[model samples]
Target: MESKALLNENSDLVLISGMCVAEVLTMQGVFTFSSMLPFFFEEWALDSIEAGWISGIYYGAYMISVMILVSLTDWLDAKKIYLAGALVTLFSCLGFATLVDGFWSAIIFRTLGGIGLAGTYMPGLKALSDRLSGKVRARATSFYTSSFGIGSALSFLIGGLIREWLPWQSAFWISASCALVAFIIVWKLLGNYPNTTGLRSGLRSLDFRPVLKNPKAMGWIACYTTHNYELFAFRSWIVAFLAFALTGSLGNLEIQPSTIVFIGVLLGMPSSVIGNELAMRYGRKLVVVSIMVLSAGFSVAVGSSVGLAAPLIIGLVLAYGCFVTGDSAAITT
Candidate 1:
């Protein structure tokens, strides 16, 4: 009975791995702009403020699209939203690869890409959650959550590696291919699960009054907001910060700033998975608060390390990156 029950719980392994891979693939183009920002700054003759908008608009679009589309998952099949988002991701990458020429065009496609991500990310998570329960569900969630870090690292590493031989646009083309593969995977492998909490007639799907009224939920929401602000800001600027800091010292380094960013983000995968385990064993509030405080201290130390040795600065950045991602799955769960 124990073995059979274990097998039953693990039967969704295909779905779990498929969704995780799809998530990773869908994220391929996310950091394309950030990884290639130096080239864009020169090619488009963009001022810092304009460049900031190009970076900022992606998240802005994501914020809006996720609120609506993820909310809709309560009523709609999450698989459908995931499919739509994957399609959008493919098109957005293709659009950016072939058509973007200047600042405005870049912004438009980045916004579209953001929307595509909004569709896949939470909706896909919802789909996965809807299909599983118990310890299997927790482990599956951690696996899925850890893929975001892998995807993020690949976003930087892939673009940087491609740009070594091919043009910058080639990275986007590859990213488009990844999205297409993700779309196909989900379309073929992910089956629709019934929404247990069916919406009642005349009631809104997105009504958040109850959520807002819950102080515990509200506290988590506030914490998540703060987490996102710092996380995104770090991702958006880490390469640039490294690039600027490494000026006159680039010749001495074996790795590029983008590679360092990749390594830093890659560290986040283990951090997230292990952090989730720790949160489960310890207390969530205790683990989260400790990680956040440690991350903030690292942030300060990194900022002050401008005149420090390159290796030391990079080490601090990697440590900071780990803590920055440590509490992610814990918070959401």
Candidate 2:
């Protein structure tokens, strides 16, 4: 009866939790960096690949920390880890605001922010999973993941506004404050749930041997990895690509580069839900493969046709963005 009551009450918790996750994730968009990358190229004396490294290092650090943080969820409560991660996010954003003048400094702080991401993302999902079971769990998970898309869109919008209107440092300061808000939300709402208090002793090794022995799971993992590589690469560079494409042609476009990126990302939220439904109707494997192929093909056209009309380039980007994120929930489940 108690559990049922809690489950009934959880709609609100899920809403708040999702929002908290969004706030934390939005911190990653400080200064609308992706949109600003082109500007930094000559100013910072950075080449393309070096600039890519500043972006890539975040995920690299995230990959390193996520295994440990998610592992700790088995022993420590997810909310506890989440709160700690929010702190890391807060400080990292602050660091970026004050410390970053060059590529190496940006890498250090962005990597720290990525660690904060490792803490909140999977662990927030874990926290949600631990609470809801059976039918409602699916909805909760979908809602939470979808919220990330919405949040990223909001970040682009907010960061663009701040960066355009004020000094770049102001955006990072606001982003750090967003992290603090995330911390407060999670900390205030979550108390220790039953069985969540047990502290498992010692470190548990992350053994991939068992999963590697299973070919089916390995295939899915491989597919998901490739899927993310393309998805993130497109996202990381899309705004800059659009801005570059608009050189001497800004008057021909309806939207600015950042706004286009925002719209592209925002539109993917429902597309993901719809794509999962389509996957169910057809098949997961079929839907995922088809989307990836289409996105890949479209992306090549986008790359080669940078000199095309701004609207055409933006349309291709929006289409690619939709397909890129469409299978997100399907792949996760």
Query: Which one is best on lDDT?
Result: 1
- Model 2 bad stretches (over 4 Å): 1-31, 194-205, 252-254
For model 1, the superposed segments whose C-alpha errors exceed 4 Å read 199-203
RMSD, every candidate, angstroms: 1.6, 2.9
- Per-residue alpha-carbon lDDT of candidate 2 for residues 167-233, written as tens digits (9 for 90 to 100): 8777788788788877777777666655533543413325556778999989998987887678667
**Worst-scoring 10-residue span by lDDT in model 1:** 195-204
TM-score of decoy 1 = 0.96
Top-TM-score candidate index? 1
Q: 99 in model 1: Cα distance from truth in Å?
A: 1.2
For model 1, how does the per-residue alpha-carbon lDDT over 1-333 read when each residue is reduced to its tens digit?
A: 999977875668888999999999999999978987777788899988988998889989998899889888888889999999999999999999999998899899999999999999888888888888888788788888889989999999987788777899999999999999998998888677776676772136688888889999899989988888888888888888888887766565578788999999998888888888999999999999999999899999988878777888899999998999998888877
